[model samples]
Each structure stands twice: as C-alpha cells, then as structure tokens.
Target: MDDQHLHDHRRLGRELGLFDTDPLMGAGLPYWLPDGAVVRHQLEEYVRELECSAGYRHVYSPVLGKRELYEISGHWAHYGDDMFPPMRLGGGGEEVVLRPSLCPHHALIYRSRSHSYRELPLRIAELGGMYRSELSGALGGLTRVRAIQLNDAHIFCTLDQAVEEARAALALIARAYADLGIRASRHRLSLPGDGAKYVADPALWRRATALLREVLDGSGIAYDAVEGEAAFYGPKIDVQIVDPAGREATLSTVQIDFHQPERFDLNYIGPDGAKHRPVMVHRSVVGSVERAVAQLVEQHGGAFPAWLAPVQLAVLPVSEAQERQAHDLAERARARGLRAEVAAEGSLGARIRAARLVPYQVVIGEREADAGLVAVRLRDGRRVDPLPSAELLHRVTARVGARGTELWADA
Candidate 1:
C-alpha cells in the first residue's frame, strides 16, 4: 500500500477542495464543497438510475430510531458498544439513538404491508445517512468517519428466490465495477465462526452460509471463504477490488439473512395459500459514496473522466477580445448537460495547467474564434490543432455521454 501509485485521498481531496472536517462541528463529519458535491451528485444520480431500472424502490428513512428498534434487530444487544450513547426522549422515557445501519428500519418497512408470493422480490433502496461512535484517534478522511451515507437496499423474497436475488445483486455489482473501469478481483464468501459475534444458530447459520457460497460458485466468481466476517445477522458475498496501492477494499456486498424476517415477523403469502417467512437480501452497488469518491479520485490520480468530472470542460480565451466567445461556448456546453467553466485571467501555460486535472480544455484566440474552432488539449499532454466547434462539441458529448474513463485524443 505504500507505493507512489497509491496516494492519500485526503491530500488529493484537500487539493481539489472536495471536503473538510471541522473540529467545532465534530471530528468525523465532512462538509462537502460545491466541487465535491457535484461529483457526488453525479455518482448518486447514476446509482439511482441503475437501481431503479433493476426494480428497487428508493425510499427515505429517519436518522433516529427508538431504542426498542435496535433491541429487536439485535443491534442493541450485539452491537451497542459501537453505537453512540443512547438519549432519552423528553428528558426521561424510551431511549433513542442515531441509526448505524439501514437494515432494521428497512425491515420495518417490509413489515408495514401484507405481501404475496407474486411480489416476492420486493426491494427497497435508500442512500441513507448513518452514524457510529468512533474514538478520536480512529477518525480519518472520508474513508473512516463517524457520519456516513451508503447505498443500502433490502430484498424481501421467498426462500426459493434467494439464489436468484443474489445473482441479480452480483450482476448489478459487476455492471457498476465495469462502468467505473475497476476490476473486482475478489469475491469473498464471508461466513460466521466462533459463536461470539454472530447469531449462534448452528443449523440456520450453516444453511445460510451454504446458500451464499452456491450463488458465488454458480456465477463462476472465484472467491475465498473467510471466517468470522459475516454480519451479525447473516452471511454475505463481498466484492473486493484492488486499490491503487495494491490493497484490497470491500465496498460492495450482497448479504442473505433468515434472521431479520423472523425477528421482524415479516411474512408473505405463498402459492399454497400458506403464510411463509420472506428471506432478506441486503445489497449495496457502491458502499459509501464519500469513500468511493475518495477511492475514485486516488484511482484516477484526481483526473476524473469527462462524465464524472466536477467541471468537465475548462474554456480559456487568449485575450479580452475572445472572452465573450469563451463564456458563450461554456454556456452552450452547460445547456447540453455538461459541467463547463470559463477560466480566470492567467498566462496561457497557467490557464492550461489550471485545467490540467479536468478532462477537456479549450483555448480561444482571435482567428480560431472567427473560424469557429477551439484549440484543445488531451489528458495525454497532446495539444491538437484547432478543431471546428461542431466537431469538438460532438467529441466531448460522446465521451461524456458514454461516461468513459479516458479522454481520448488522436495520437
């Protein structure tokens, strides 16, 4: 992990004005700047589109939950030490606390309505914010923090549909990783061991673990079985990728649980006209938005693709004579759903350098402006001849629309 290819996202985030944590506002909460928020917005919007198309219904949940809620979910008894200290209602009553995960609350939603076998794979998704109490020394940039938001969803399905749901989840993860241009090199079947941390049901635990392994094997995803990594509630398949520094990271996962449905008393009507418990599958396409963005910035060395770039195109005018033309071009790009900006006054080298980290750069001069052409620079340090305005726009739109990782140039 200590290679030049591996750089600290904290430093890169700072340099890019992405986010910051202030002591007065607390140690682990980050305030996202505009530049960072734009990137996050793009990531989340893309996630919503993907999940929605996959039949997940996005929903909103409250940040705080009753103490009894976690008790039923087993979090109060099994995971209380990691949670923030509980607070009493109206000075002294039922205790409430910030939610550390979205599963329990999501479980309550499934229990809210009666369901049928036909509606078996009902998935509810949320990019929910959660909180945990961490010691001061443990808090670092976005990667390790107290406050976090994750792409969380719980699937309610019959036992017969478990493997299929798991397959669907793996497909989603595969597509997401492919689009990000990163390889998910590890598929880990995380199972329970040592009756200490997980629910100690020997028979139930073994069955759940076997089902997850079957799904992974059936998909032909090579995985290593890891002991004692399953969630307190269930077994999971963790998709891990090699980060820039050669360290493995688990940011996407699919979990199957026979526990939550039973604990929450969730049931669905089966074809035999009998009520049966629905299995719960929890999955996240991308785990934590902030941490993923941090990973991405470091992965690409802070030069984001045109589609994901906070500012996709940087337009620079050589002199005051061409300033209006630059702004006009920027507006046109913006109208076409691109993030574009006009460069501030600076020397040619300075202006180009300022926009170096961005995907595309356009320099406007008197003759080129009159010719409806803009000189552009590619990420490979290749400065191409002035191109027709229509041609440049077409190329930029194609790259952004495809959300490609590289800004291609003719070598």
Candidate 2:
C-alpha cells in the first residue's frame, strides 16, 4: 500500500494510541494500548450483555488442547495448515497446540455430561483468545492478525431446533449492527460445491443445507448463495458489510454443522427415551476484537461517540488559580460515570487544542469557577457557556449513559 492508499485504521491507530503490532514481538500479534483496551473492554461488555439477555451461558476453556481433541473435531485434518506447530511435554505427554478455535473445547464441555431434551438448546459464549500461523506476507494491521480475540459462541441443539437458532443468531447480528449505525449489507449463503475442501456426507449435507435455507428464506432478507465457500464441516450464512471507505468484508456468520457432534459422539436424551445426536451452530457477532476496533476507528475517523470514547471529557483550567476547581469538577464527572480528567501541565489553549477525539472539553476560568459553573466546548467548536456544574454533568452523562447514536445533542 502506498502512502496515499494507506488505510485510516493504520494511521489513526497510532495517532490515537489505539493499537500496534511489533515485528520484533512477532508478526500479526498486536498490543492494545490503554486507549485501545478501554474500547475493547466496552465491546466485550456490550456483547456479553447481549448474550446474557439472549440466554447464553458463558464459559472458559484452555488455550492449548490435546491434538486428539482436534482429531475428533476434524480440525487436525481440515485446518492444520493454518495452526501453529504442536508442542509435546517432557513427561511423555501427547502433542498440543494453541487453539485455533474454541469450538472443540466447548464441544468437549457438552460431551462431559448428558442432557435431556428439555434442555433443547444450550448456548455457550466466550470472548476467547486464539492463534493461527499465517504466512508473513499475508499479515497486515488488525484486519489480518495471527493472534485474535473472538466474540465467539457455539450452540448445541436438536436437528429440529437448527432453524430457530439460526434465525435468532441473525437477529442478534442485525440488532448489533443497527445499534452501531452500520449496515449489514446482505446474507450470503455459503455452500459446498465441486471442491476437495468440503466434507462428503451427501445425506447430512443435504439435510443441514436445506434447514439453513429454510431459515433464511423464511426471514425475507435478501441473500446471495455462493458455492465453494462453506467450511469443511457444513454450510453457513455469511453476513457481508462494507467498511467506511467502501471496502466489503465478511463481518459475522452463523454456521450449521452436522459433523462435529457426530465426530465427538455428543448426545442428548430424547422424549422417546432414546439417545440422539445434537447439532452444532457456530456463530460470531464481531469476528475479532482487533478487527472490530479497527473498523470503529475508521468509521468515526477517530472521533468516537460519547459513550465509547476513551476520554469522554477533558477539564482545562485557565491558570493555577482554577486548578483545584478543575480537578474537583473532574472528580464530580467521574462520580457520575463519565471518563473525565483534568488536563494538567499545558497552557489552557494548548490543552484544549490537544483534545483530538475527546467529545467534550470543559474550560474553567475565573468567572465560571466563582459561579460554580463550567463552559462546555464540543467537538464541532460550539461553546455552551455559564451552565451550573450539576446541570452540565447531567446533560453530558445523559447522552453517554443512554448510548445515543447520531441526532444526539448534549445539554
């Protein structure tokens, strides 16, 4: 990429102190700075809240798993090329590798105990860390990183429950995109075709693919069915979205799998008093935290909305006399849950000028400090002067606390 063609995500990431990848540390391994961590934390919290309300039970699993685990899930055969090399312990242990995906471990959790049909669908979710060994030439900023943290979840349910589960996953994905003010362009139904990559179980593939189509067709959403893009295990629905610069990318997906459960021998007790295999649905709302953060940086051009900004408010004192007032005001804003701070060690004008992505800048002078008030400066350079401190805090906090999107105004 040339200097003129450079992605804003790479430029703004350093300018805003969001994230960085070190070639010395390793290619594609990014370190999130303090500002970046705050954004990532908010993303995780938002998704966790959504999953909780949707009846998903969160869990933790090992970062490294026995080679046999992937052997059963078929990753060793189908996806081994992308994974890191195996490591063996000195105590005569079997081969293990950093997990390339969390589904295999989650599958083992389900297999650990038997369930009744009453537990028709079990949803497992996690903000999981995973690794893959990609060619150095292919690695770029956060978008194509080797190390990633996933907003991943897996659902175990009966064959009859796949359609409802798939539809529900789509609903969550749609709601999330809408809340972020981004469009989910289209649903792409990825299928098996005349390729050696796809798993060959004609009867299972037919059944699974048909059920997924039923859900998409019933939902009335426009979609394109593409062949040779499905995973080896099964077919899936890939949601396509365009970035700020008109570049398209696959941001999220819901897959129907008939292979993993069968390979792992996972079963649930049926209403007929017999054991039956459960199906698996793999889904992610935001595929990788790093990539999502990059998208947000570019989407807003580093000017994040009030709710998600790392530094929501900056308090600037006109001189040493008003320094105490500045700090007190900052504390007051913090008590109200705003990420506020007192801007110290700079001229009043310099401090305000340095407020790049800060949504609100409060400038305190002699008259305002005496009247127990603040002067609010917005990103657009408009000033709201001489407001009571309490009132100032209320307006800013309301917009942030409500998570309001565009068409938002502060008091």
Q: TM-score for every candidate vs. truth?
A: 0.95, 0.92
The per-prediction tally of clashing pairs is 0, 0
**Model 1 root-mean-square deviation:** 2.1
Could you give me the TM-score of model 1 versus the true structure? 0.95
Off by over 4 Å in 2: 1-7, 91-93, 244-246, 344-349, 380-385, 406-411
lDDT of candidate 1 over 1-411, digit per residue (tens): 464434677877888998877888898888899899988999898899899999999999999999999999999877888899888878568899999899999999888889999987999999989998988898878877898889999999988898999889999988877677656778898887785568777777888888888898899888899988888877899888665557677889999898888899989999998999999999999899977887787777777767888888889899999999999999988888888999958797898888888888888989898988999887668787888866887788887887657676442
10 residues in a row with least lDDT, candidate 2: 402-411
The regions of model 1 sitting more than 4 angstroms off are: 1-6, 242-247, 383-385, 408-411
